[model samples]
Target: MASEAAPGSIGGAGTALPRHVAIIMDGNGRWAKKRFLPRFAGHKAGVEAVRAVTRAARAIGIEAMTLYAFSSENWRRPEEEVSDLMGLLRIFIRSDIDELVQENVRLRVIGDYRRFAPDLVKLVDDAIARTAANSGPILVIALNYGAQAEIAAAARSLAAKVVAGEMAVEAIDDAAIERELDTHDLPPLDLLIRTSGEVRLSNFLLWQAAYAELLFVDTLWPDFDAAALHQAVTTFAQRQRRYGGL
Candidate 1:
Protein backbone atom coordinates (compact mmCIF):
# COMPACT_ATOMS: atom_id res chain seq x y z
CA MET A 1 0.00 0.00 0.00
CA ALA A 2 1.08 3.59 -0.61
CA SER A 3 1.15 6.29 2.05
CA GLU A 4 0.64 10.04 2.40
CA ALA A 5 -0.23 12.44 5.16
CA ALA A 6 -3.84 13.29 6.03
CA PRO A 7 -5.68 15.76 3.84
CA GLY A 8 -5.72 19.53 4.61
CA SER A 9 -2.65 19.45 6.81
CA ILE A 10 -0.85 22.53 5.59
CA GLY A 11 2.82 23.66 5.60
CA GLY A 12 4.29 20.50 4.10
CA ALA A 13 3.14 20.31 0.48
CA GLY A 14 1.91 23.91 0.34
CA THR A 15 -1.78 23.02 0.05
CA ALA A 16 -1.24 21.58 -3.42
CA LEU A 17 -3.85 18.86 -3.51
CA PRO A 18 -5.47 18.45 -6.89
CA ARG A 19 -9.17 19.09 -7.33
CA HIS A 20 -9.47 16.57 -10.16
CA VAL A 21 -7.63 13.29 -10.67
CA ALA A 22 -7.60 10.77 -13.51
CA ILE A 23 -6.32 7.21 -13.44
CA ILE A 24 -5.55 4.58 -16.04
CA MET A 25 -6.05 1.29 -14.23
CA ASP A 26 -3.63 -1.15 -15.83
CA GLY A 27 -2.07 -4.61 -15.43
CA ASN A 28 -5.05 -6.70 -14.37
CA GLY A 29 -4.10 -9.58 -16.67
CA ARG A 30 -0.52 -9.43 -15.53
CA TRP A 31 -1.61 -9.47 -11.94
CA ALA A 32 -3.77 -12.51 -12.51
CA LYS A 33 -0.95 -14.25 -14.30
CA LYS A 34 1.35 -13.60 -11.38
CA ARG A 35 -1.20 -15.11 -9.03
CA PHE A 36 -1.80 -18.13 -11.27
CA LEU A 37 -5.45 -17.15 -11.42
CA PRO A 38 -7.86 -16.47 -14.23
CA ARG A 39 -7.72 -12.96 -15.73
CA PHE A 40 -11.29 -12.27 -14.65
CA ALA A 41 -10.20 -12.73 -11.06
CA GLY A 42 -7.83 -9.82 -11.47
CA HIS A 43 -10.60 -7.69 -12.91
CA LYS A 44 -12.80 -8.52 -9.96
CA ALA A 45 -10.09 -7.37 -7.60
CA GLY A 46 -9.67 -4.20 -9.58
CA VAL A 47 -13.31 -3.42 -8.95
CA GLU A 48 -12.70 -3.49 -5.23
CA ALA A 49 -9.79 -1.19 -5.74
CA VAL A 50 -12.06 1.18 -7.60
CA ARG A 51 -14.44 1.24 -4.68
CA ALA A 52 -11.65 1.95 -2.24
CA VAL A 53 -10.16 4.71 -4.36
CA THR A 54 -13.48 6.38 -4.95
CA ARG A 55 -14.29 6.55 -1.27
CA ALA A 56 -10.80 7.83 -0.54
CA ALA A 57 -11.08 10.55 -3.15
CA ARG A 58 -14.37 11.73 -1.73
CA ALA A 59 -12.96 11.69 1.77
CA ILE A 60 -10.13 13.92 0.63
CA GLY A 61 -12.48 16.43 -0.98
CA ILE A 62 -11.60 15.69 -4.58
CA GLU A 63 -14.17 17.28 -6.86
CA ALA A 64 -13.77 14.93 -9.80
CA MET A 65 -12.34 11.50 -10.51
CA THR A 66 -12.04 10.08 -13.99
CA LEU A 67 -11.20 6.42 -14.50
CA TYR A 68 -10.08 4.95 -17.81
CA ALA A 69 -12.02 1.71 -17.51
CA PHE A 70 -12.16 0.41 -21.07
CA SER A 71 -10.53 1.82 -24.18
CA SER A 72 -11.71 1.48 -27.78
CA GLU A 73 -8.67 -0.68 -28.49
CA ASN A 74 -9.85 -3.11 -25.84
CA TRP A 75 -12.52 -4.34 -28.24
CA ARG A 76 -9.85 -6.40 -29.94
CA ARG A 77 -9.62 -8.71 -26.96
CA PRO A 78 -11.34 -12.09 -26.99
CA GLU A 79 -15.12 -11.89 -27.07
CA GLU A 80 -15.31 -13.71 -23.77
CA GLU A 81 -13.21 -11.10 -22.01
CA VAL A 82 -15.26 -8.29 -23.51
CA SER A 83 -18.42 -9.96 -22.32
CA ASP A 84 -16.92 -10.45 -18.89
CA LEU A 85 -16.08 -6.76 -18.66
CA MET A 86 -19.61 -5.85 -19.61
CA GLY A 87 -20.89 -8.17 -16.92
CA LEU A 88 -18.67 -6.48 -14.41
CA LEU A 89 -20.02 -3.12 -15.44
CA ARG A 90 -23.55 -4.27 -14.80
CA ILE A 91 -22.59 -5.71 -11.45
CA PHE A 92 -20.84 -2.52 -10.46
CA ILE A 93 -23.80 -0.37 -11.31
CA ARG A 94 -26.30 -2.58 -9.59
CA SER A 95 -24.22 -2.96 -6.46
CA ASP A 96 -23.09 0.65 -6.14
CA ILE A 97 -26.02 2.77 -7.19
CA ASP A 98 -27.68 2.95 -3.79
CA GLU A 99 -24.38 3.45 -2.00
CA LEU A 100 -23.35 6.12 -4.47
CA VAL A 101 -26.59 8.01 -3.99
CA GLN A 102 -26.25 7.80 -0.22
CA GLU A 103 -22.69 9.07 -0.46
CA ASN A 104 -23.77 11.92 -2.73
CA VAL A 105 -21.54 10.95 -5.66
CA ARG A 106 -22.73 11.70 -9.16
CA LEU A 107 -21.68 9.17 -11.76
CA ARG A 108 -21.06 9.97 -15.41
CA VAL A 109 -19.89 7.72 -18.17
CA ILE A 110 -17.99 8.99 -21.23
CA GLY A 111 -17.51 6.86 -24.32
CA ASP A 112 -19.27 5.46 -27.36
CA TYR A 113 -22.37 3.95 -25.84
CA ARG A 114 -23.65 3.05 -29.31
CA ARG A 115 -21.30 0.06 -29.35
CA PHE A 116 -22.62 -1.43 -26.14
CA ALA A 117 -25.37 -4.04 -26.01
CA PRO A 118 -28.86 -2.67 -25.42
CA ASP A 119 -29.15 -4.24 -21.99
CA LEU A 120 -25.82 -2.87 -20.83
CA VAL A 121 -26.64 0.55 -22.25
CA LYS A 122 -29.88 0.62 -20.33
CA LEU A 123 -28.10 -0.26 -17.11
CA VAL A 124 -25.55 2.51 -17.62
CA ASP A 125 -28.22 5.05 -18.44
CA ASP A 126 -30.20 4.12 -15.37
CA ALA A 127 -27.15 4.47 -13.15
CA ILE A 128 -26.47 7.92 -14.53
CA ALA A 129 -29.99 9.11 -13.99
CA ARG A 130 -30.16 7.69 -10.50
CA THR A 131 -27.04 9.51 -9.37
CA ALA A 132 -27.49 12.71 -11.36
CA ALA A 133 -28.83 14.56 -8.37
CA ASN A 134 -25.90 13.72 -6.08
CA SER A 135 -23.86 16.73 -5.04
CA GLY A 136 -20.63 15.03 -4.04
CA PRO A 137 -17.68 13.91 -6.11
CA ILE A 138 -18.33 13.53 -9.82
CA LEU A 139 -17.18 10.10 -10.91
CA VAL A 140 -16.43 9.77 -14.61
CA ILE A 141 -15.96 6.35 -16.12
CA ALA A 142 -14.43 6.15 -19.58
CA LEU A 143 -15.67 2.88 -21.01
CA ASN A 144 -15.26 2.08 -24.69
CA TYR A 145 -13.30 5.32 -24.82
CA GLY A 146 -10.38 6.37 -27.00
CA ALA A 147 -8.74 9.77 -27.00
CA GLN A 148 -7.95 9.65 -30.73
CA ALA A 149 -11.43 8.47 -31.57
CA GLU A 150 -12.96 11.19 -29.38
CA ILE A 151 -10.88 13.83 -31.17
CA ALA A 152 -11.74 12.41 -34.57
CA ALA A 153 -15.43 12.38 -33.74
CA ALA A 154 -15.24 15.96 -32.54
CA ALA A 155 -13.44 16.98 -35.72
CA ARG A 156 -16.03 15.26 -37.89
CA SER A 157 -18.82 17.15 -36.14
CA LEU A 158 -16.97 20.44 -36.52
CA ALA A 159 -16.29 19.74 -40.20
CA ALA A 160 -19.94 18.98 -40.80
CA LYS A 161 -20.85 22.30 -39.21
CA VAL A 162 -18.42 24.09 -41.52
CA VAL A 163 -19.76 22.30 -44.58
CA ALA A 164 -23.32 23.17 -43.56
CA GLY A 165 -22.33 26.83 -43.06
CA GLU A 166 -23.22 26.62 -39.39
CA MET A 167 -19.63 27.37 -38.38
CA ALA A 168 -16.84 29.11 -40.26
CA VAL A 169 -13.73 27.00 -40.87
CA GLU A 170 -11.56 29.72 -39.39
CA ALA A 171 -13.65 29.86 -36.21
CA ILE A 172 -12.94 26.24 -35.36
CA ASP A 173 -10.45 26.02 -32.49
CA ASP A 174 -9.64 24.35 -29.16
CA ALA A 175 -12.69 25.61 -27.33
CA ALA A 176 -14.97 24.41 -30.10
CA ILE A 177 -13.37 21.00 -30.03
CA GLU A 178 -13.72 20.82 -26.26
CA ARG A 179 -17.38 21.72 -26.47
CA GLU A 180 -17.85 18.73 -28.76
CA LEU A 181 -16.09 16.29 -26.40
CA ASP A 182 -17.99 14.00 -24.03
CA THR A 183 -16.35 15.65 -21.02
CA HIS A 184 -17.05 19.23 -22.08
CA ASP A 185 -18.55 20.41 -18.78
CA LEU A 186 -15.87 18.88 -16.55
CA PRO A 187 -12.72 20.70 -15.54
CA PRO A 188 -9.38 19.77 -17.06
CA LEU A 189 -7.48 16.95 -15.37
CA ASP A 190 -5.17 18.14 -12.62
CA LEU A 191 -3.40 14.81 -12.06
CA LEU A 192 -3.14 11.71 -14.25
CA ILE A 193 -1.99 8.50 -12.54
CA ARG A 194 -1.38 5.05 -13.97
CA THR A 195 -0.96 1.79 -12.06
CA SER A 196 0.97 -1.46 -12.68
CA GLY A 197 4.11 0.38 -13.66
CA GLU A 198 2.80 1.31 -17.11
CA VAL A 199 4.23 4.55 -18.48
CA ARG A 200 2.09 5.28 -21.50
CA LEU A 201 -1.14 7.25 -21.81
CA SER A 202 -2.86 4.33 -23.58
CA ASN A 203 -4.94 6.92 -25.47
CA PHE A 204 -6.65 8.39 -22.41
CA LEU A 205 -7.68 12.02 -22.19
CA LEU A 206 -4.91 13.04 -24.61
CA TRP A 207 -6.30 16.53 -25.11
CA GLN A 208 -7.23 17.22 -21.50
CA ALA A 209 -4.00 15.90 -19.98
CA ALA A 210 -1.79 18.33 -21.90
CA TYR A 211 -0.94 20.14 -18.66
CA ALA A 212 -1.72 17.49 -16.02
CA GLU A 213 0.77 16.13 -13.51
CA LEU A 214 1.38 12.37 -13.83
CA LEU A 215 2.12 9.74 -11.19
CA PHE A 216 3.26 6.24 -12.07
CA VAL A 217 3.08 3.28 -9.71
CA ASP A 218 4.05 -0.38 -9.93
CA THR A 219 1.10 -1.67 -7.92
CA LEU A 220 -1.39 -3.61 -10.01
CA TRP A 221 -4.87 -2.18 -10.39
CA PRO A 222 -6.34 -4.65 -7.89
CA ASP A 223 -3.82 -3.64 -5.25
CA PHE A 224 -4.25 0.10 -5.59
CA ASP A 225 -5.76 1.46 -2.38
CA ALA A 226 -6.66 4.65 -0.63
CA ALA A 227 -3.06 4.96 0.50
CA ALA A 228 -1.84 4.87 -3.10
CA LEU A 229 -4.38 7.51 -4.05
CA HIS A 230 -3.35 9.78 -1.20
CA GLN A 231 0.29 9.43 -2.18
CA ALA A 232 -0.54 10.35 -5.74
CA VAL A 233 -2.42 13.45 -4.62
CA THR A 234 0.42 14.41 -2.30
CA THR A 235 2.91 14.03 -5.13
CA PHE A 236 0.68 16.13 -7.33
CA ALA A 237 0.65 18.85 -4.72
CA GLN A 238 4.41 18.97 -4.65
CA ARG A 239 4.76 19.72 -8.34
CA GLN A 240 5.31 23.19 -9.77
CA ARG A 241 2.47 23.08 -12.30
CA ARG A 242 3.99 25.58 -14.72
CA TYR A 243 1.49 24.58 -17.41
CA GLY A 244 2.80 25.75 -20.83
CA GLY A 245 4.90 28.65 -19.60
CA LEU A 246 7.48 29.29 -16.88
Candidate 2:
Protein backbone atom coordinates (compact mmCIF):
# COMPACT_ATOMS: atom_id res chain seq x y z
CA MET A 1 0.00 0.00 0.00
CA ALA A 2 1.12 3.58 -0.65
CA SER A 3 1.76 5.89 2.25
CA GLU A 4 -0.83 8.56 3.08
CA ALA A 5 -0.15 12.18 4.01
CA ALA A 6 -2.29 14.83 5.60
CA PRO A 7 -3.42 17.64 3.29
CA GLY A 8 -1.15 20.59 3.74
CA SER A 9 -1.75 24.30 3.76
CA ILE A 10 -2.98 25.79 0.45
CA GLY A 11 -0.01 27.92 -0.46
CA GLY A 12 3.34 26.67 -1.84
CA ALA A 13 5.46 29.32 -0.08
CA GLY A 14 8.31 28.01 2.02
CA THR A 15 7.47 24.47 1.02
CA ALA A 16 9.23 21.91 -1.15
CA LEU A 17 7.23 21.48 -4.33
CA PRO A 18 7.49 18.39 -6.44
CA ARG A 19 9.77 18.58 -9.47
CA HIS A 20 7.77 16.01 -11.40
CA VAL A 21 4.01 15.53 -11.23
CA ALA A 22 1.62 13.25 -13.11
CA ILE A 23 -2.15 13.36 -13.34
CA ILE A 24 -4.77 10.77 -14.19
CA MET A 25 -7.56 12.79 -15.72
CA ASP A 26 -10.78 10.92 -14.99
CA GLY A 27 -14.58 11.36 -15.00
CA ASN A 28 -14.93 13.19 -18.29
CA GLY A 29 -17.85 11.03 -19.34
CA ARG A 30 -19.58 11.52 -16.05
CA TRP A 31 -19.13 15.24 -16.23
CA ALA A 32 -20.68 15.35 -19.67
CA LYS A 33 -23.57 13.13 -18.65
CA LYS A 34 -24.36 15.34 -15.73
CA ARG A 35 -24.67 18.28 -18.10
CA PHE A 36 -26.90 16.34 -20.54
CA LEU A 37 -24.20 16.62 -23.15
CA PRO A 38 -22.27 14.18 -25.26
CA ARG A 39 -19.14 12.56 -23.95
CA PHE A 40 -17.07 14.43 -26.50
CA ALA A 41 -18.22 17.66 -24.89
CA GLY A 42 -16.54 16.57 -21.69
CA HIS A 43 -13.37 15.64 -23.55
CA LYS A 44 -13.28 19.03 -25.22
CA ALA A 45 -13.63 20.74 -21.88
CA GLY A 46 -10.90 18.49 -20.53
CA VAL A 47 -8.55 19.92 -23.13
CA GLU A 48 -9.11 23.34 -21.66
CA ALA A 49 -8.34 21.89 -18.27
CA VAL A 50 -5.10 20.53 -19.67
CA ARG A 51 -4.08 23.95 -20.90
CA ALA A 52 -4.83 25.51 -17.55
CA VAL A 53 -2.96 22.81 -15.64
CA THR A 54 0.05 23.09 -17.93
CA ARG A 55 0.31 26.81 -17.36
CA ALA A 56 -0.14 26.38 -13.62
CA ALA A 57 2.47 23.65 -13.37
CA ARG A 58 5.06 25.67 -15.27
CA ALA A 59 4.36 28.72 -13.15
CA ILE A 60 4.71 26.70 -9.96
CA GLY A 61 8.28 25.64 -10.67
CA ILE A 62 7.42 22.10 -11.70
CA GLU A 63 10.04 20.71 -14.07
CA ALA A 64 7.80 18.09 -15.69
CA MET A 65 4.09 17.30 -15.69
CA THR A 66 2.80 14.12 -17.29
CA LEU A 67 -0.85 13.73 -18.20
CA TYR A 68 -2.50 10.38 -18.81
CA ALA A 69 -4.26 11.49 -21.93
CA PHE A 70 -5.09 8.09 -23.33
CA SER A 71 -4.62 4.52 -22.19
CA SER A 72 -4.17 1.33 -24.13
CA GLU A 73 -7.44 0.08 -22.70
CA ASN A 74 -9.28 3.12 -23.98
CA TRP A 75 -9.38 1.51 -27.42
CA ARG A 76 -12.23 -0.59 -26.16
CA ARG A 77 -14.50 2.42 -26.19
CA PRO A 78 -16.92 3.07 -29.03
CA GLU A 79 -15.43 3.76 -32.46
CA GLU A 80 -16.93 7.23 -32.70
CA GLU A 81 -15.46 8.17 -29.34
CA VAL A 82 -12.03 6.99 -30.40
CA SER A 83 -12.19 8.97 -33.61
CA ASP A 84 -13.28 12.06 -31.70
CA LEU A 85 -10.36 11.65 -29.36
CA MET A 86 -7.94 11.39 -32.25
CA GLY A 87 -9.40 14.49 -33.81
CA LEU A 88 -9.13 16.40 -30.54
CA LEU A 89 -5.51 15.38 -30.19
CA ARG A 90 -4.73 16.70 -33.65
CA ILE A 91 -6.54 19.94 -32.94
CA PHE A 92 -4.67 20.32 -29.68
CA ILE A 93 -1.28 19.84 -31.33
CA ARG A 94 -1.98 22.14 -34.24
CA SER A 95 -3.55 24.79 -32.05
CA ASP A 96 -1.30 24.66 -29.00
CA ILE A 97 2.13 23.80 -30.39
CA ASP A 98 3.01 27.42 -30.94
CA GLU A 99 2.03 28.47 -27.45
CA LEU A 100 3.89 25.51 -25.98
CA VAL A 101 7.03 26.45 -27.83
CA GLN A 102 6.62 30.10 -26.93
CA GLU A 103 6.24 29.25 -23.27
CA ASN A 104 9.34 27.03 -23.42
CA VAL A 105 7.31 23.98 -22.55
CA ARG A 106 8.83 20.94 -24.22
CA LEU A 107 6.08 18.64 -25.48
CA ARG A 108 6.74 14.92 -25.35
CA VAL A 109 4.48 12.03 -26.28
CA ILE A 110 5.25 8.66 -24.73
CA GLY A 111 3.59 5.49 -26.02
CA ASP A 112 3.32 3.31 -29.11
CA TYR A 113 3.25 5.73 -32.00
CA ARG A 114 2.74 2.94 -34.51
CA ARG A 115 -0.85 2.54 -33.42
CA PHE A 116 -1.80 6.05 -34.55
CA ALA A 117 -2.65 7.18 -38.07
CA PRO A 118 0.19 8.45 -40.23
CA ASP A 119 -0.90 12.08 -39.94
CA LEU A 120 -1.32 11.90 -36.19
CA VAL A 121 2.08 10.30 -35.84
CA LYS A 122 3.57 13.06 -37.94
CA LEU A 123 1.93 15.71 -35.79
CA VAL A 124 3.33 14.18 -32.60
CA ASP A 125 6.81 13.83 -34.09
CA ASP A 126 6.75 17.35 -35.42
CA ALA A 127 5.65 18.73 -32.08
CA ILE A 128 8.54 17.01 -30.34
CA ALA A 129 11.03 18.21 -32.96
CA ARG A 130 9.78 21.77 -32.81
CA THR A 131 10.21 21.93 -29.05
CA ALA A 132 13.42 19.92 -28.85
CA ALA A 133 15.46 23.05 -28.19
CA ASN A 134 13.25 24.38 -25.44
CA SER A 135 14.87 24.45 -22.00
CA GLY A 136 11.92 24.79 -19.70
CA PRO A 137 9.10 22.83 -18.13
CA ILE A 138 8.28 19.60 -19.96
CA LEU A 139 4.74 18.39 -20.66
CA VAL A 140 4.57 14.65 -21.16
CA ILE A 141 1.44 13.18 -22.71
CA ALA A 142 0.91 9.50 -22.09
CA LEU A 143 -1.02 8.41 -25.15
CA ASN A 144 -1.98 4.76 -25.47
CA TYR A 145 0.53 4.02 -22.73
CA GLY A 146 0.33 1.01 -20.44
CA ALA A 147 2.75 0.61 -17.58
CA GLN A 148 2.76 -3.22 -17.60
CA ALA A 149 3.42 -3.26 -21.34
CA GLU A 150 6.27 -0.80 -20.89
CA ILE A 151 7.81 -2.95 -18.16
CA ALA A 152 7.58 -6.06 -20.30
CA ALA A 153 9.11 -4.32 -23.28
CA ALA A 154 11.98 -3.05 -21.16
CA ALA A 155 12.56 -6.53 -19.82
CA ARG A 156 12.65 -7.95 -23.35
CA SER A 157 15.25 -5.39 -24.39
CA LEU A 158 17.44 -6.31 -21.48
CA ALA A 159 17.01 -10.00 -22.20
CA ALA A 160 17.96 -9.47 -25.82
CA LYS A 161 21.14 -7.68 -24.76
CA VAL A 162 22.06 -10.56 -22.48
CA VAL A 163 21.39 -13.06 -25.25
CA ALA A 164 23.73 -11.12 -27.60
CA GLY A 165 26.40 -11.07 -24.84
CA GLU A 166 26.27 -7.25 -24.88
CA MET A 167 25.18 -7.17 -21.24
CA ALA A 168 25.59 -9.74 -18.52
CA VAL A 169 22.52 -11.04 -16.73
CA GLU A 170 23.91 -9.90 -13.40
CA ALA A 171 24.32 -6.36 -14.76
CA ILE A 172 20.54 -5.87 -14.99
CA ASP A 173 19.39 -3.71 -12.11
CA ASP A 174 16.82 -1.05 -11.21
CA ALA A 175 18.95 1.68 -12.74
CA ALA A 176 19.40 -0.30 -15.94
CA ILE A 177 15.68 -0.92 -16.26
CA GLU A 178 14.93 2.74 -15.61
CA ARG A 179 17.12 3.74 -18.54
CA GLU A 180 14.89 1.65 -20.78
CA LEU A 181 11.65 3.24 -19.54
CA ASP A 182 9.99 6.09 -21.47
CA THR A 183 10.62 8.64 -18.68
CA HIS A 184 14.36 7.99 -18.35
CA ASP A 185 15.26 11.56 -19.33
CA LEU A 186 12.74 13.18 -16.98
CA PRO A 187 13.02 13.91 -13.29
CA PRO A 188 11.77 11.34 -10.81
CA LEU A 189 8.00 11.37 -10.28
CA ASP A 190 7.22 13.21 -7.05
CA LEU A 191 3.44 13.53 -7.02
CA LEU A 192 0.63 11.72 -8.82
CA ILE A 193 -2.92 13.12 -8.81
CA ARG A 194 -6.11 11.41 -9.91
CA THR A 195 -9.31 13.33 -10.39
CA SER A 196 -12.91 12.05 -9.97
CA GLY A 197 -11.91 10.41 -6.73
CA GLU A 198 -10.19 7.48 -8.37
CA VAL A 199 -7.76 5.64 -6.10
CA ARG A 200 -5.77 3.61 -8.59
CA LEU A 201 -2.65 4.24 -10.64
CA SER A 202 -4.53 3.08 -13.76
CA ASN A 203 -1.20 1.93 -15.23
CA PHE A 204 0.40 5.36 -15.06
CA LEU A 205 4.14 5.65 -14.38
CA LEU A 206 4.03 2.66 -12.04
CA TRP A 207 7.80 2.30 -11.85
CA GLN A 208 8.59 6.00 -11.71
CA ALA A 209 5.99 6.65 -9.00
CA ALA A 210 7.53 4.26 -6.51
CA TYR A 211 7.85 7.01 -3.92
CA ALA A 212 5.43 9.60 -5.28
CA GLU A 213 2.74 11.21 -3.19
CA LEU A 214 -0.78 10.34 -4.41
CA LEU A 215 -3.75 12.68 -4.15
CA PHE A 216 -7.24 11.74 -5.28
CA VAL A 217 -9.80 14.47 -5.71
CA ASP A 218 -13.52 14.45 -6.48
CA THR A 219 -13.33 17.09 -9.18
CA LEU A 220 -13.92 15.72 -12.66
CA TRP A 221 -11.30 16.19 -15.35
CA PRO A 222 -13.27 18.83 -17.20
CA ASP A 223 -13.68 20.84 -14.00
CA PHE A 224 -10.05 20.64 -12.93
CA ASP A 225 -8.37 24.01 -13.10
CA ALA A 226 -5.25 25.92 -12.15
CA ALA A 227 -6.50 26.41 -8.63
CA ALA A 228 -7.03 22.68 -8.24
CA LEU A 229 -3.50 22.07 -9.45
CA HIS A 230 -2.10 24.60 -6.98
CA GLN A 231 -3.97 22.91 -4.16
CA ALA A 232 -2.59 19.51 -5.11
CA VAL A 233 0.97 20.78 -5.25
CA THR A 234 0.52 22.47 -1.92
CA THR A 235 -0.70 19.19 -0.47
CA PHE A 236 2.31 17.47 -1.98
CA ALA A 237 4.67 19.99 -0.44
CA GLN A 238 3.61 18.87 3.00
CA ARG A 239 4.09 15.14 2.55
CA GLN A 240 6.99 13.23 4.16
CA ARG A 241 8.64 10.87 1.75
CA ARG A 242 10.48 8.30 3.83
CA TYR A 243 11.41 6.06 0.90
CA GLY A 244 11.49 3.05 3.22
CA GLY A 245 13.89 4.71 5.66
CA LEU A 246 13.38 5.60 9.34
Best by lDDT: 2
lDDT tens string, model 2, 1-246? 112222222343457778888999999999999999999999999999998888877766778899999999999999999999999999999999999999998988888866999999999999999999999889999999999999999999999999999999999999999999999999999999999987899888899888889899999998998888888887886778899997
- Candidate 1 positional error at 53, Å: 0.3
Query: In model 2, where do residues sit more than 4 Å from their true spots?
Result: 1-12
In candidate 1, what are the lDDT values of residues 1-246, reduced to their tens digit?
A: 333334453224447667779999998899899999999998998999999999888777778999999999999999999989989988999999999999999999999975899999999998899999888789999989999999999999999999999989999988999999988989788999999997999999999998899888999999889888877876777789776788
lDDT of each: 0.87, 0.88
- Inter-residue clash pairs, candidate 1: none
In model 2, pairs of residues that clash are: none
